[model samples]
Target: MKKALRRYWQTDFWREFFDTFLNISDCQNQPNLSHWGRKISVLLKEDPSRLRETCRLLRIQDETILQAPSF
Candidate 1:
């Protein structure tokens, strides 16, 4: 049950992230958001722990994303 909840929330999370990314990127006229968004999604799936580190690195590459990864 706990694992199922985790999976459900994970799916919800990626969906929300993609939606938010597209909305903000579209507003800013960003063409590279798709690439970055996919990168983040994959990282979240592969290793939630490392996602924050990855986001930090990506922030260095592009600080446009107003919100950074949370714990």
Candidate 2:
């Protein structure tokens, strides 16, 4: 299950994420940006450990996110 999600991590899900993230340059997109931010916050809060898997799957370079709780 994890492998499959990682394999398609760059699909629609990531596309929307990157689009919202990259749109930070525009003030008008603040709503969209905050939406994603809240969503990420909720997910991380639910399972901090998933942060590491998320980083690995997304190829994120931030080591800080890996400090999430386990199990």
Candidate 3:
């Protein structure tokens, strides 16, 4: 189960996440952003380095943007 989740996190997660964000952004949904932000905050608290590595693997250059959720 962990492996499957890890795989999803590394792959489909980013795609779906970005897609969802774009949709939410287009709709000007603040609540959805807050919900997603909480999830990201929890993930960051769980493993910062791993998150960083996953972002790096995904070629996510916006480190500050990624870290913003935990603030």
Find the 10 residues in a row with the least total lDDT in model 3. Answer: 1-10
**Tens digits of per-residue lDDT for model 2, 1-71:** 23434425336656777776666777654745577788778756687667777767656433434755567
Q: For each predicted model, how many residue pairs clash, with residues at least 3 apart or on different chains?
A: 0, 0, 0
Looking at model 2, residue 27 earns an lDDT score of 67
Better of 2 and 3 by TM-score: 3
RMSD of 2: 9.2
Residue 2 local lDDT, model 1:
12
TM-score of each: 0.27, 0.38, 0.41
Residue by residue across 31-52, what tens digits does model 3's lDDT show? 4667778877786668888777
Candidate 1 RMSD to the real structure:
14.1
Window of ten residues with lowest summed lDDT in model 2: 1-10
lDDT of each: 0.59, 0.61, 0.61
Candidate 1 stretches with Cα past 4 Å from truth are 1-43, 63-71
Off by over 4 Å in 2: 6-31, 60-71
Residue 10 in model 2: shift from native, Å?
A: 18
Cα error, residue 62 of model 1, in Å, equals 1.6
All candidates: CA RMSD in angstroms?
A: 14.1, 9.2, 10.0
Error of 1 at 50 (Å): 1.8
